[model samples]
Target: MSVPGAMIRCMDLTRFFADVDAQPWADLHHAYGSAADIPDCLRALAGESEEAASEAISELYGSILHQGSVYGATARAVPYLARLAGAGYRTEDLLVLLGGIAEGGADEGDSEEAACRAAVVGQLPLILAKADAEDPGLRRAAAWAAAMTGAAEQVLPVLRLRRKTETDPGVRAELLGAMAHLDPPGTAADATAAIGAHEPAEVRIVALLACVDGGLPWGPAHHAAMLSLLPVNDLVEGRLDLERNEPLQYVVEELLRRDTDADRDAAYTLLDGALRSADSEARAEALWAAETACLLSRSAPERLAGAVEAMVADPADAPAAYSLLAKLGVRAAAAAPVLARLAAGEGDPADRALEALVAVAPDRAAPLLARDLGRRPRALGAACGFLFGGAAGASFTYDPELLDAIRTRLAEAGGPGADEVVRLVNLLGAWGSRASAALPELSAVLSLCPGAVPKALVAICPPEHRGTTAELLTAAARTGPEEGRLAAAAAVRELTGETGPLRAAVAARLTPGGPAVREAASLAAGLGPEAVALVPALRSALSDRAGDRNIPQMDADVEIAAALWRITGDPEEAVPVLAGVLAEVQPMWLRWTFGRAARAAARIGGAARPLVPALEGLLTEPMQIPSAVLALHAIAPETLDGPRTAGLLLDAAEQDADAETALDALVVLGPDSLTEDGRRRLIALAERDLRVRASGLEPGIAPADERLREQAREAARTPAKP
Candidate 1:
């Protein structure tokens, strides 16, 4: 077959390096293992089928850049890969690989990333030429790659020109985005001008965001303008992507900004009408606005209660409404009767309603909960589901008699013969050490509920029962599936602070293995420094294993990296891997990504400074903002002084979802970092926190806000301390 421009370019790439078939790949290392497979992966991309190309890209991503950390082989491969990209063979995937590789290896763990990025950047012109390629997809991808790898100064002009001539809205958006990356506008006027310019919503939105990224002022006018761009038809039909919600979210956050009374009142009016809107999108967004207002005490909580409860009537909408209600705490007490009635119904609404009701109307909910618990022996599973179903349920005050009755019921129920029995047993397990009274009952069903049983036993056992718990854990470890065994290992480690017996199991599981490796890695992670002996094994597990035909869980490398950090106390060893994991996971923003790896990096204290960049990447994610800021402040306090980080925290504190976490990070920054804009941000955060408390919510974490405020003040007074 006659080679296309892409394959010819790829053929030229071979000259930049050893023949793919000739390279001694086994000696060269990647995240998972040797680099030998990389050549195969590289060759696989030259194949005709998309599947082969995709598989090759996937393998490359997994091995060379597992999660996000770059390996030695990755750096070696970039120049040749860039040539392939320049030639336009599998350009999008190549760019993705290049981008991922470029984002990594800045740390000691993955030392090759920096060199690889520089090499790739050196090939910028070839990749940039694709911006003018006849293929629009390649043009779009090339623009993104420029943003990801190429110099902003060199790429910006090209992007601007492309924006002028681009007919494709998507391509235009990408150009504007790439431009934004190069020199984002840095003032309210520039942002307004950029957004108000003749451009598609995607381009305009990117421009506004770029302005924020550029440390621009974003005030009520900007807020109002962003919201105004939301065409009504799109909102009602849910035609817009998740990105479109960013502007609406900003409007909701307008309450937290230091704005005029007129703006505040106008925002309230705008939000209130939206709250009343029948369209789910509008109402949902309005509810978010109302929650922030309520939390800030800028708007009355009651104003949004009816809308929330009405929204809750639909099962699909209930989870979100219940989440707000959970935040509302007792402020939504007036909705208690409504919640209780809803809980009496069935499925998700019942579970969420019960959880929310327990928070707002505990006294009112107790009887309803008691009724459900005793309603029928078969209803026991659903009843347990109601109590332990949502996150808020952990805080629910259980009636002593009901607890006693459930224990008694479980004792009489014997082994879990049904799915419901397994669930009930799991709930009893979740009750933890406080529910130790149910241990005997739980142990009886150990075989039936292998996964939950050992965890429960270890969690709930008294100090006196530690040996007994260890015994049971060992037994479970020997008897259950890989997950069950790991769970048992983690549990036993917790109680005994010993890893000797589990070391063999850990080594056996933490290898080039299957899906079960994830569970094993998680257990090792949870074991903390106690699993020190498994460090080498963990490192081996993290290596590329393309030869192995096993599908590991997503972010498996992250868990192993986190465990390595916790166990070894070696930031140089752990931080880069954690950062890599963060790089890999942050773009996805999965709820689970905020788990051990991020926490490990945060707790590693000052030595995890290398991870600051990775942590900062997550600052834009509302769910991740708190963790990101907290990690930043803990690892490198001085870094946040720069506008972008501080501005991000300030923005985070403005939102209801992230307020507590944002405040937590601010407090951690102490008074020194809290002065000036930092001080104002902390003050606003404190005020918002106080408003949440004053709203009569549970105040579970916010009362600590004042203490945090005082700590900052103390730091201010001390001034002598660094």
Candidate 2:
């Protein structure tokens, strides 16, 4: 268990075990409930059995440093771990754990995080001594652990000194990475020198990455060195840092960071060359880099599409190729032939290929989906459209083959799962009255799956079938599951505008402790003035503050408030609730509740004047601007400085920061509200080929970008005030 001729000696084991026992371990907290078990886990680390020690290390990682989150117990455990590492009890593993703890806390800046880092920093003298240990593993572990302390002044000098005497290629690579972590700019010269022809490939790979990390100019020599190291994964195996497992990806990401055409071209060239390599691992690595490039650069999808498509020819590479093609959207349309062949074939990856084919070319996928209707759930979901976020393949036009296939699936006994049934009904609903032929199957399944069927029935029901649909909905509203009842009631209202039979059901749902409070509030709001009787129930539900911090509860409150305003037209009763929600909710990015509250406030017009300051405050937020502008325009138009509002909209549009909202506001403001400069910007946005918005790596960015451009053109054509 001990190292021979060890320069760094262990702390006295007797005293270390005593110190560990003295600490109040039970009182500490980790990710899972309590840290009482942590003491036993720590004691096992010093035990004679290596298996016991490994298990203890894993246990500690799961608890105190769970997923890189340092807890109260994390700092207390650090001193013991550092001393054990110094004592040469599993020196490599202990140092790696200590390094993870140190780096985990470095960026978080909380007191617990600071204490964890400080605990490791206290053991620097012992850790640095191991940087030159006789064991290469100890040297590598010590170098990584020391750099993780982020104490550049103390750690960098030791790393630089070790770099000179390091003989093992892996250890040398570790030393180079450690120095680069401490100071990238300062290590640039060392990195450039190490990339010479004589250095080991492992060392050269790390050195090239260090050069890129330092923002050093990448010239012909660096390019030649990188090309010569194609399939460098094997060379740097078990040597490179965890983050740089895929070295080419790191290089291409750094190049793309420059955000210039030349840098992008360089990245594409490197990826293309790697893709053409005969090595499977090399092509796999390049595929990952190509995916990253496509996500970042506007030109990457087109430039790298052919290279990525070539990957599908290899059967092992087909799954990843399908996923990347799906993300590429319309940009990878050229791969449809290959994807179609894979989709039509029978294999585990066949469904994945169909899904990708659906995203890239829905017209081609529709018939295939139709031919294999009962089997492909994911492809069906893709074609039916995502509930959240923009997804392609929802643009499936009226194809008789597809409609007939869906109708056949619906009519079959025990055909699809509950989720698939929902997708099928939703797809039929989207087609509206044109899907009347499927109405008979929908009616038969109404009682079996009442929640989705009622809505679909209302959508596809012709004028002659309205009476029959209303009767079906009314029966379901009267006698079905709570969800079905609410859905049926809503559909009945849509079909016949009668809120009579569902009044008691809506009242019962608004009784504070129900699961369908939000749905009931929405249904009541649809009743408008006819929902006056449920106002007291709504007020009582709003007063229930049991789940006040819950996002869904807050959303229900907004819905109830909107229902109140719609029923009674009382600003005093509703605006305050709307304003309260606006104040309590935050981070408008994902929280649709804040936007919902704003829209409700806008609906009240000038009576929502009390929300003016809050709405005006929201004008500064890119995501909130459209809601704020619409509210301000409704509540108090004089408060809006047209020029300033126009400027903010333009800034949001150009940066793709909530460009959809910004464009909606511009269209609402009309042509006259825009300044001369703003008009010019709007026209330029419409004409530009490079997307002003929707430029992220998501599956539907291409379709989203096209929609934004079309919206911009519409805003440009909007007539000035008469």
Candidate 3:
């Protein structure tokens, strides 16, 4: 394009040059006449003539030994070419060309080479100084260049400062990306300390990644501080708090990998804190976190003993107790004294103490476990299992005194502890398989105690004990209040594999009218299609009032769906029933059923297609079976591809009260649906959602749904090529 009405026309053009042609400079030779007339060629290169511009550029390239030839002329052209570098360039080539002037004086030591380097560097400084620019792209480019030029001292310090003060998140994030590639230009530790102080989540996150990759030492004290900071509500400002500062996440992992006392102690502290955190993810994380702690502690018998002492002293450190006992499982004999003392303790820590020893007491530890089963009355069902695992049979002699003490507790006025004794006897009957010995005492507890004891007996009792327990359950399953019936049904599910009499006892309880009876029936159905007889009762229970109060019934419906899906492979059996429940059920329960149905249906392969309409309807409502959409998306993404699907999503986005719900619909519709009008609407909704999330006032339900939608969108965009 040429400038209009100018004495010397200035034109800007883009073209490629190749050396493969015989007369590679044909255009230049044809325009400028010869290579000797370089001055006129340089003037014409700035003019509108394309041929002159080519010759001028080529002559400038050829002059390696001159005071002021085409090289110096182009040196004055450096500012003009800098914009091209900012746009996009073969950056390494550009850097090398610039470096030749700055470092090597590559133009044969001519003053022009010096002048060219000065001019390029002068232009480059403007770009470098703007690394802290408010514009994200400019800041990103500047930071990239600064990194490329080895901005160890000057650029890093400015980037670090701007990382703290910059308000524009994108700019801050880009600067951080640039900052991560460069060393901090001092002691690695000092550099980490400097960058770690930056503010806002974007920069701090990058700084953390950098610090982690930079190989900083993260010992016990460092890791403990980080663990304290978890369950973070704010990522940036929250990090600045000394309480929130921890060794970097990667550093902690590396510490775990190394064999050292510092690592072991840090791992122990982290596991203790993680297990106690209110967050479920954190709790789950704590389980694996102990692996290295266990290894590094080298099954230390003394340390295990110390942990027991600490637990006994504090009484509040439950995780520490569990950790100590779990670790002791590896030190079977060394743990005997601690387990015996804990099993015998009659003090405030007694309940906790028993819980600790139940799993750790060895095969020979069975005697200790068995002794406690009769004398120390707490968590009896658990104690029975310990006895079974420890001393498996009639081989171990039982103390009559201990058995008598249990019988006395059962006969006396019962507190919560008395019930614990009955549960213990049931456990013994279940595992010991000696129903003949305990039947009298077990029947008495079933007849006299609160309903829970008998129900537990039904669950734990072995095939031999099932005979009497089944008789008890059948007689009482229908007669008790709703709670008793549900309890009876749960027990029936547990005893499903016992003798014919017990199986029949469970079958008889799968009756109509009561949610408890139906729930038990559903559970029975799950055991096998033999209990498919219970399906009629389950189908009828679906008509029962579906509300928050009917949690058991909702639970029964899912079990019924799963049961039906398992037996018939009929989407017909589950879909209509599940859809009916979805239509009338409480939101939470409905969500639960939808998720179950979707999973079950998906497991049955394309047999789930009929349920897609219902799943889609719930998905449109946001958080209403969100997991189901993923199943549908996986099985039938094409269903969401049509215009009708787009229209439905758009309608949902507009009509829904929750911004997240609408955002999710837009995301499902995908970027292809973003016409100018649609784009504007989405942007507006996004801004509103952002504000709501920022203020902590919006419900996360819809936003969480949008996150799922975002994940789906990203998955769809990834190409198949490796």
Per-residue CA lDDT of candidate 1, range 1-722, in tens? 24685466656766644556566678889877878787767767766787988888888878888887777787778876776666556876687567666655342233466676776677778777888877777777778777666477677777777766888766765666566555655223444666764766655665555555555555555555555554332321221122334555554454434344554555555665565566776666666656666555434455455555565556556666775676566777766767777788766557667767765776676566655553333234333444333332244555666567666666663423556556565555556667788777777667666766676777678888789878877877776666567667767777897776576567778765456666677777666777777888888777453332212333676677667767777767777766655655343446446544567677888998777777777766765776777776668877776445545655655544455555556556554554465655555544442342332333333333344455434433422212
Candidate 2 is scored at a TM of 0.85
Candidate 2, run of 10 with poorest lDDT? 387-396
- Among these predicted structures, which one has the highest TM-score? 2
Candidate 3: lDDT of 187?
Answer: 30
lDDT of 1: 0.62
Residue pairs with backbone overlap in model 1: 25-36, 31-543, 32-543, 32-544, 33-543, 33-544, 433-460, 674-679
lDDT of 3 by residue, 45-122 (tens): 445576765665555445421332324444544444453333333223233233333332322355755666555556
Comparing 1 and 2 by lDDT, which wins? 2
List TM-scores for all candidates, in order. 0.55, 0.85, 0.42
TM-score ranking, best first: 2, 1, 3
Residue 236, candidate 2: C-alpha displacement in angstroms = 4.8
Question: Model 2, residue 127: displacement in angstroms?
Answer: 1.7
Candidate 3 CA-lDDT value? 0.47
lDDT scores in order: 0.62, 0.80, 0.47
